[model samples]
Target: MRFTFKCYATKHPEQTVIFTLLLSIFLLAYQLRIYEVPYFRMIGLKDFEQFESAVWLVVITMGTVGFGDIVPVTIFGRMITMVASLWGAFIFTLVLISFGSRFNLSTKQKQAMHQLVSQHKAARLIISAYRLYKLKRSKEGMGSNKSVLSESDKGISSLMRRLKEMAKDFKDERPKRRRVKNSKSQLI
Candidate 1:
């Protein structure tokens, strides 16, 4: 049964919500039944109907609204109400935590996306600066008029070399995976 439920939940998230709602309703109904049973009523409350009303009242209380219309008159009835209240509170808390976690995850994802965009803009700015510097030097006849442009060329070459080295380092750090064989074969 547990495995079947897990499979259903994995395959369909909507089904999980339906299941949870149904389970809550079933539990509420079962509690009502326990209250109505003759043996349980004999030891618990004045009457089963009163117990039923009390259970619903407790549900409302757990929802943070106290009507004060129905009250538990017996120790056993009060004990049942306390148990129901605690379970209801716990289920409600679980729901809040689930929503909170999703909100936190989405916020973190947005922050990461913003950081990536900013980094890309910074890289573009640096490349643009390098291009502008090159264009200015070329227009000034610094290289074509027999004047030494070695310093500027050296700077550009060094920058390109550093970029290449960084790329190589990144490639080296990547995980290696086996490639699948293709259907085509070549004759040597």
Candidate 2:
């Protein structure tokens, strides 16, 4: 019966919503009956005179919290209690899966995100290399006539050039955007 309910719910989500609401009402009514009847035999209730106490018991049972305060003595009551606990677990699992899927990234989106991160890192390297190059050039002084490049300065220059090339490659692969004009801009 639980398997059938799950299959039907998966096939028809709109109907599942309605069925879930109706089932909740039915369970609440059944629990109320369990509390009102003397033959059902549930422990932990000081008094069965109030409807609120029955609702609380139903909630506690549905949550699978058998606080040992309330227990079903009859076989029928025990079956009902088990059904409520399993049903609650099933509902909770479904809700979590739906939410997880909603937030999950697709393969294409993940790839694009990876490309964006790589591009950002490349751009940062380019900027850092250019800054180092400028600092080296400034330290040599404007009055110096020497045109010779040290090994370290030559390496920094090569790194700066390579980073620029990588940045250009990344830019070429990025998607192009179209411009849209607002009403005010169109009027202008």
Candidate of highest lDDT: 2
lDDT of 1 by residue, 30-133 (tens): 56446545554577655445445545665675564657666554465566566666766766675565445545434345545555555665575567567656
Against the unseen true structure, what C-alpha lDDT does each candidate score? 0.55, 0.61
Where does candidate 2 stray beyond 4 Å? 1-25, 28-32, 40-52, 67-69, 106-115, 131-188
Cα lDDT over the full model 2: 0.61
Q: TM-score of every model?
A: 0.41, 0.48
Which is the leading candidate under TM-score? 2
Model 2 lowest lDDT segment of ten: 175-184
How many backbone clashes can be found in candidate 1? Answer: 0
Cα lDDT for residue 174, model 1? Answer: 31
